[model samples]
Target: MLHHQAIITDIKAIIAQSQEKAIRTIDHQRTLMYWAIGERIFREEQQGKDRADYGQHLTAYIAQALEPELGSGFSKRQVELMRQFYRTFPIANTLYSQLSWSQYKLLLRLDSHDQRTFYMAETVKNNWTVRQLERQIYTNLYERLLVSNDKESVLAVAQNEQLPSDAKQIIKDPMFLEFLGFRRESAFYEKDLETAIITHLQEFLLELGNGFSFVARQKRIHIEGDDFFVDLVFYNRLLQCFVIIEIKTAKLTHQDLGQLQMYVNYYDRVEKLPHENATIGILLCADKNDAVVRYSLPAGQKQIVASQYKLYLPTEQQLLAELNKELYSFEKGE
Candidate 1:
């Protein structure tokens, strides 16, 4: 009876695996078809380069004719997307077979060649779902990295050409938590905010950027008979270290930095293995004075960082202000 049951389970597993592979193959073929269509349109447009506005007219005519015969995917905007897609990708041979139509559609929206390439390399490297990719874009992850590191390093790290030596290289300040379903006006305790992050742990990890895996919440530590609970703990495989995170509901202060430094010290002395890198600590709070943070940590401190968190997506102006502020401060070592 046991043998029979095992055989049945194995058969079911094989069938499921086969179906998954079949779907992937079909999606790849569909992607290729779109690429081929794009190539044809691009070649036609190139041939008619002598005529002013011919490309626009050609695309419009193609959309009108294709929509009636083939359906929704060939609409005006989408046909243009196909054209842009081909132009951006250029070589059909270089198209990533693992990507779906939806992923390609999102990639088309990025404005810069470098940005598109970085995001694509990361998307493939991280095996991100469409939702995760969308969230990364809205959070402006690429720009955040650029502010911290040189352009060459940023591109290199994105494509896995170099490893991150400091946690700040990968960490984003004022991480967006709009996915937590909390209103910006909502008043909450640190515990309440921590609870929300724990509840939406997956999204939080995604927002935390790559190579992070959750370990514990409200992790308890004892020192000279006093007990303290770290709000969250995670291990970053890429960094080869443990990350201790503390949550703060209001403005950050030197006291908070001291508390975080203690945690980092504890992890480095006790939790970190000889083979592992020094553990890092992040004090995630609702607001921060950059001057305060700058002065709080010792000169050449490597293990502790403070960053703010927001309940809603910041406006373009707000983000721009932050980028300028951070760029100046980070360069000044403040």
Candidate 2:
């Protein structure tokens, strides 16, 4: 009986795998079909280059003729999108086979070439679904990463040219916890936020960046009869270090930094193996003063990072303002 059950399970697994492969194959073919359509439309437009509105008229004419026979997929708006798609990705070879038409539509909305490239690489690397890719784009993950690192480093890491050497390469400051469903106006304690994180741990890990696996929560350590509990502990495989996160619902102070530093020291000395790199400590706080964070840690300190957590996603304008503020401070060599 057990052998028969195992055979049934194996057959089910094979069927599931084959179905997934068929779906991927169909999506890839659809992407290729769209690309071919876009290329043909673009070639037709170029033949009438002297006419200013030729491309627009040509697209509408084609859409009207095709929609009657091929249905609404060839509507004017979608046709225009196809034209833009070809313009955005001129080289057919550069199109990623793994991305579906829906994902490409979201990518088409981005204005910057570098931003598009970064998202494309990340979507493939992370196996991001259409909704996940949309959320990342809407959250402005590319711009958020750029706030700390340079463009080249961000692109290089996304392209897998090099492994992440520093946590800052992947971690974002002002981490968004809106998915935790906490209201911005409501008051909450650190434990409440921690519970919310634990409940929505998967989204938190996605927001936490790559290669992070949960280790423990409220991890206890005893030293000379004194006991202490770490709020959250995680392991980052890429950086090969343990990440200790301490939640602070109020503005960050030097004392908070000191406490986190102590935890980091303990991890380095006791928990970290000889082959592992130094443990990293992040103070996830509600607000922080940049100067205080700078002066709190010792000179040339790289292990401890203070990042703010937001209950809501910031608007593009707000992100721009924050980016500008960081850029101004960086320019002053601060």
Q: What is the lDDT of residue 330 in candidate 1?
A: 72
Q: Estimate each model's TM-score.
A: 0.93, 0.96
1-334 per-residue lDDT for model 1 (tens digits): 9999999999999999999889878998988888878888888988895644877888899999999999988998888888877888888788877777889889888888888888888888888888888778767788888776887787787889999888978888768888888875877788888888889998898788779999999999998899999889999998999999999988998999999989889988888899999989999998898789879888778898887888888877787787778778778866
Candidate 1: which stretches are off by over 4 Å?
A: 1-4, 49-52, 316-321, 324-334
| Displacement of the residue 178 alpha carbon in candidate 1, Å | 1.0
Local accuracy of candidate 2 as per-residue lDDT tens digits, 205-247: 9999988999999999888899999999999998999999999
Residue-level lDDT for 236 in candidate 1:
97
